[model samples]
Target chain A: MKGLDLNITIVGLGLIGGSYALALKELQPKKLYAVDKDEEAIKVGEEMGIIDKGFISPEIPLKESDLIIICIYPKDIKDFVKNNIDNFKLGSVITDVTGIKREFAEEINAGLRKDIDFVFGHPMAGREFTGVKYASKEIFKGANYIITPTERNKEESIKLIEDIAIGLGCKNVEKVTVEKHDEIIGFTSQLPHVIAVSLVNSDNLGVDVGKFTGDSYRDLTRIARINTKLWTELFMGNRENLINQIEEFEKNITDVKTALINKDMKSLSEILSKASKKREEMS
Target chain B: MKGLDLNITIVGLGLIGGSYALALKELQPKKLYAVDKDEEAIKVGEEMGIIDKGFISPEIPLKESDLIIICIYPKDIKDFVKNNIDNFKLGSVITDVTGIKREFAEEINAGLRKDIDFVFGHPMAGREFTGVKYASKEIFKGANYIITPTERNKEESIKLIEDIAIGLGCKNVEKVTVEKHDEIIGFTSQLPHVIAVSLVNSDNLGVDVGKFTGDSYRDLTRIARINTKLWTELFMGNRENLINQIEEFEKNITDVKTALINKDMKSLSEILSKASKKREEMS
Candidate 1:
């Protein structure tokens, strides 16, 4: 259970995986290993000293590691786990850093070996850039970490994951039900991405819109440069909650449009003031 | 029309005005004067050496200044210019930093003194914080500056404003028709604010959503702490264009929602990819 004494393996060494490997290196684990289909990423991780060793497949690393951290697209999680379930060492703890939880947790736990435990987690931190070369452990500093443990999860496994999250410099480690996690994330994460993408795609200005943009426009659309295949998986996996969030946002946009069209300055002012107050409260 | 020798007067000593005053100090104008009904802002401006003198009324300052920069709300531009019509120095150049332009330009030009030229402008720079105390000229460094010169504007007046914009550290000085200015600002500036306000207002999550948010949500909602009164005027002043922009954005959002509802991963991925490519081009 000691963080520094355990052997750790990271599956999928991209931005998140590379960052986790870099951060976990600080814990001084006995042996830090990584599995990535992209051999270049694994080679870079080893060169950067982020991982002690690298593997193209999980068979050998999974059997020796005491903890396995999977950092891959949400759609690939089930297949990855199901295909490698037998390779995982008995009594080892497993966790993931995907955006969605409920269904993935249920599917994985349904067929998971009783001796191996999977503690679901999500670290609320990332950059617009991709790849292992862009990865840094600093992204985790002061970030929020969430754990969604199902009924079958053990306290010891949850505690182990929490300890690692804290060791990675997370500011808050909160536990929420899988349903609540998805619902809140729908509002806080998915909705913002949807809005950013929509804003960018709504570009009708023929001129270089970048020249006319201020800080607000720049910041709002910063994430619009998204990873297509990955986000498609996420948007579809958490379909219902994300749709509800988008609809709620659409309703708000309608309210503003109506007030503007009717020249109801009073109503528009109130809406803006309420939003301003709410944003201040968040700070 | 030497930059350092001219007498400059900044009307309405709020965030934009105060920042302009501070930036203009670098030019070391012969005299820097600011007028604001908020006498406290004027006093602070004078004490901080941002302005050489302060005035409660524009009458006296307007009579002597060679350059006047009006940084007031969009709705007040006409009234301010009307009230001070006879006071402006003969052949002196005047400009403004309001978000909207077309109507204000026409209305002010209708009864404006022929000798005093009013060159319309909009600085593509701002902060969520307000008032003279929060103002910093650094906001203009690398920011865009737009000039919407009407038919009545003299070439010399437009050149003077452009020079000052460069002196103030603006990265680009673009000239566009008043109508074009409004159209572009609707998409670049106003639409982002509308989205930020709407996103913050659509808070259905009962939980403290801050803990669950990542950089994307924080960046997207940062401007939700808006100046409600000022934005109300800007939103209404540029009503039609902003409405069109919002409708366009809504259509894009609906595209995303429809794709999600039908579980059309390919279409959704295409939409996201298009947005991502457009955003990358902007960068």
Candidate 2:
């Protein structure tokens, strides 16, 4: 402990947190602190030797930490920051693994003691499964990490957070304003899920879609089975931007509807051709 | 060709037609006639030895065929049958690998010579590639074949069409009325394609989506790159039912929009959970 530079603490040892611990373990931090409401998670982390020690509460020696990373649900993000930001040492950086960044980043910065640095980044990788047992550091190997930094953020703090994302093996580490982060993700991520759910609920298809699906139905609805509680929060958190995306999609579909009704083969064919070409270019 | 039992002519030797010839080749048909506008395709079929003879037009030997299978676009079905149905030998059956059924079946049956039969069936198999070069008999090995029989379809004629479908290596040969076929496909097949196209056209997704997409966007948009001409016809041929299906989807999305705006987690969670459960149940 005499001369070691980094003291890292990981809070909430679920899929993301435990994966972060496994990733940070390779860095060989002087001390790794593990905190979770679920005691079993901490026990598993310590048993796996991914943590130097485990804590069930935030009231411990958090001020000693150089960096603290949070990986809980979006709903829990603010209260945890409010309760624990004071316990962190002055000028030390804190970041998160939350997928959405806008409101959370704003709230965290506004609520924090200005001396304590809070930088927000979202590692865009996940699995269908959850919990510490299912976590693996390899999830970050080719994944994206987007940092949403406001003007209030210090350059050094942002740099420190970006360095951690890079060291965690993220392939793309970039910065965006909180507004851009929500809008881009609304179109690419949230809207796709919204569309899938809508398509799945379109009908109680009498035929077992499983036995008879061609590539279309099967591929489009593959994400239909989703985490409801988590997604509800995520969707509700970004509803306005998502609804805006949905409206744009509705406009596209309306064009198709008009073409189909008018039997305007030229227009329909053009739209489809453009979409097909765009999809190819995307690849 | 003297004293041979079976004489088969495949009209429009595209992917499905070429694959059919390869599969039928094993049966050692006394004659396998290939008709396509692209004489290059006919030569390829002849060179590949998948066809006994190639024709640049459907004009030759429609009367000699024991069975003639059409593999052209759905838009060509009505005219092709009107001009050539009388040429087929008495009591012979003609079929198609067309994707949709009801209206085509009605029009062909109404226009056909009473002595000859045009039995409408859809081979539920395909590849992204087109033309005889891309055809494979193996595409039908585990694929579903739906035989949509109209009231005009004679029992003997329907049986002959089913025999051909089964012989081509279909795993399931299910029968439904033309009405049922359109309705079922409206939800399972057409709706999904519409959703994918709409989502792809939602925004000019400027990011290299292939780089950052996880399961949701990648899996959902796999079918966004579709055959424009063919799908447009399919969508047009079955527009009313597809529009109905789209309305059902619109309703579902409206429900989601309501839930999101109201911050009604209970309602939002219910919708997601039910969709997930239904997807699992379908599987």
Candidate 3:
């Protein structure tokens, strides 16, 4: 299907869904639609001209959409797919924007309609702010997009998703296995959130430490103002991989602490320099 | 001791020193002088009009200046003070911009010339990039300035430093004992660097994890491209307090890890919510 001729529908009009609607508008789909539980979100999205139409019920939009992007909570995805199994258009492409992918991919692939193409995707972009009101197309600009494709997916479906990711201003589109996706996301996405939360929680100073903070503290904890319910679900969903990543991080912290206890400046300097060199290579 | 009539000399023209010179220029000091072992740094400061004169030796400027700001490595501050003890003009105010303050304050207070007043101050601002070339006066704008005073410090000298801190555009000028300053800094400054370095070093995915990163990972590790030599000195000089802070942080990480391992969503949600609340309160 040609990108410009397809009808696209976004489910859940929160930050990610709303942002997808705004960004996908650039493709000028034949019709852009959104199905959100919140009437305010749908009204706002339509009023903002991000979507051509909005629906509180998914049955109508799902039947017409050539491409459907699911942007709800991870735990609710299975039910959304199961409940709407009969509503989806025949031969339509389905994608998701969830952080964890392994279990969802397995469950959805096994139970999904054989005529539908479910290509799992994760757009690695977000803001600390939540809701449709804060959504912007600019979040995906120069961001990474990951495609975790299963054997059930077709070549054309993956290509269609990659093309859309690029159209949304992604700088890189890399393919990985569902397992690889979960493990890497455990480190790159989930671990950073864990660390930021822990760092903020560890503050024991009676006085407001904010007055004494520099760029280091502020930058490090910028994401500590988190979405609690969503992140808890993300954390529990990928528990094993996240636990391993947390252990590795804790061991590294122990190494630094041991060096500090021994007053071993040589080991300390080596560790810091290695991290510095590695970080420099990243950019 | 009036601001307009006083001559100010900045010792050791690195990032902090160069920035002080640039910001202090707004006060239009009778003469702004800089002394540094790096002749090129002094030359650049003078050529950029951040300072009126550059000195390879501290003797001339130290003898004439009424207020002297020392900005050098933490380990070298003692030696610089000892060597330049006689060069300081009688009753001139002296200050420093080091991260750790307890040990330096004690040693300097016990051995300082009775006439010269040493008021220990730490400007809570820095960039990941180092040296005079990257220096800008804007770093201190709305930044925190901390003054840690001992019994040896004169009230007038502390007041003068506060005035300069405000003149340099610091949002807050806070006073604390040396012990309190070091303890709070260990939590606010050193612990964040330790966590950043550890987070970068903990990357075991083997693949280029950078491609998968979002704002959370990038923001948390921005300081991982650290000034190794200087930070090593800082981490070691404040070893005890830093170790305590690290242990506290490790405990919090363990709590999250345990919650994940147990699949206790209630505990996980509460932890994340508390952190979110605390972080929201910070801003």
Candidate 4:
């Protein structure tokens, strides 16, 4: 709510953290502190001037900071949060940039004290390309920031999260439950990547067809080049939504296969027509 | 085959036809001719020197050409071929630039007189943009040209078609049955378009998202803004393959959905991991 002069501590100086650091620099935070296990990341962040202060270890530095944003891989967030929760000052508002939520939410809700405002958030933008060096202050421009809040979260925490998103140059910010966020992303984002990867794999790309591919082949399989550890963890974390979205594709494809097998022109036309119309309407 | 001096004529002067005309001219065709119902297309092609002679109608010019390449919309090809088959010079090759084949192969093979060779070929290269102005002589660079030959066709005719593909600057020329060509394209090409159209149409594309789309999104969805009439006819023509491809997608997606619904983390991880590996192996 107030101007972001609040001391902001960002954990994990990866692409998201580095970008957040650079983004908040324009706002002139009272003090910006970054912590990461990777000294190289911290060193890069400092060299790039993404943050004012850096620490190699996870000690919650001077927890009186107004906000603490966790920017780490989804699987690591829980342990990192556990390590830092005790040192977070009593009134500090905490948030995260994790792709998945339920598990992280449960961990944070149960791990941290009630005095700390911890609302989970995800900024839905990034290249398959990763790391701090690739980080840009402008990457967040016009990207969506979804804030996951529960009844347990204080209203002020949600406001602070929204403010942080807006401060980071996010064009749109909306409040959503953890479940809703996971489900929507599964359909709109994560599942698409899965599909892309599957299509590319099935085509036996990387060797021959990769060079011959036109724009369509390239675009559809763009997300195939992923950070396996992070994605596998995310898929496992958001297992429910991922499975559902994949199922939707499966059912649609099966019906299509049946029509093809039967040589049912009408059904085939109707199917693509419906998909086309739906796609058009959504656009 | 003999330096392409066989009275080469192209019907429809859009990107494909115009490019083909330009390529033929470079090969020193006997008398390059262009016919299009669009008077503007004829004027433009003549002015651009893509073709030496231009005709506003197909009927009169169809009698003189030794080889006629139909570059019209798939829906219009049947009528165009039917009306012009009687006019085609005896012992000449009649080919098409349509993406779909089974339907075309059946009708053209059965309908045409025994003298003319009807070999269906498709050069898998195009831009989202269209028209004679967008036609590039270099569009076919490194692209695949599929020659769909039936058992009834002569090897000499196939060789002539192969030569045309090479002359167009395409190197990956392969002979495939109509069914196989449709099947392979249905998965590798058509499905990508469908996915792109769906993804693009999903929401009002923020200008920022558009800017951040990178090469992958651009490449994948390049065919999104398609020529609807042509694509519609192509889909119907190769209904079997299209349906099968769609079904494959459905199955893949369904597997994903089940993984999510049941929280089957292992299955989801394996699928994503395998898919990523598969894509990495591709070109």
Interface RMSD of each: 0.8, 1.9, 0.8, 4.6
TM-scores for every candidate against the unseen true structure: 0.97, 0.81, 0.97, 0.77
Which lDDT tens digits does candidate 2 get at residues B1-283? 1233678998888888999999888767788898887889999999988998999867665767888888889878788878776567777778887777788777777778877777788877877677888888898887778888776678987887777667777777878888888888888788877877877777664666655455577667767788998998899999998888888988898888888888888999999998888877774
Off by over 4 Å in 1: A1-3, B1-3
lDDT (C-alpha, whole model) for all candidates: 0.91, 0.80, 0.92, 0.73
Give the clash total for candidate 1: 0
Candidate 1 residue B197 C-alpha distance from true site, Å: 1.0
Residue A49 alpha-carbon offset, candidate 3, angstroms = 2.3
lDDT of 2 at B266: 95
Scoring only the second chain, what is candidate 2's TM-score? 0.90
lDDT by residue (A11-88, candidate 3, tens digit) is 999999999998888888899999998999999998888999999999999999999999999988899999999999
Candidate 4's clash total is 34
Q: What share of the true interface contacts does each candidate keep?
A: 0.90, 0.63, 0.87, 0.31
When sorted by TM-score, best at the front, the candidate numbers are 3, 1, 2, 4
What is the per-residue lDDT of model 4 for residues A1-283, given as tens digits with 9 covering 90 to 100?
2346688888888877888888888888888999888889989988988787799865546475778888888777778778666777877788887888876798778877778778888887777677889888787887778888887888877887787778777877877678777776665667667778667645522225653455567668878877777887788787766665665655555655565567666775666656555433331
True-vs-predicted CA distance for residue A51, candidate 1, Å: 1.4
Give candidate 2 misplaced runs (Cα > 4 Å): A1-36, A39-69, A86-93, A113-117, A127-144, A152-173, B1-10, B18-34, B43-55, B58-68, B86-93, B113-117, B127-143, B152-173, B204-213
Clashing residue pairs in candidate 3, if any?
none
Query: Best candidate, DockQ-wise?
Result: 1
**Shift in Å, residue B25, candidate 2:** 6.8
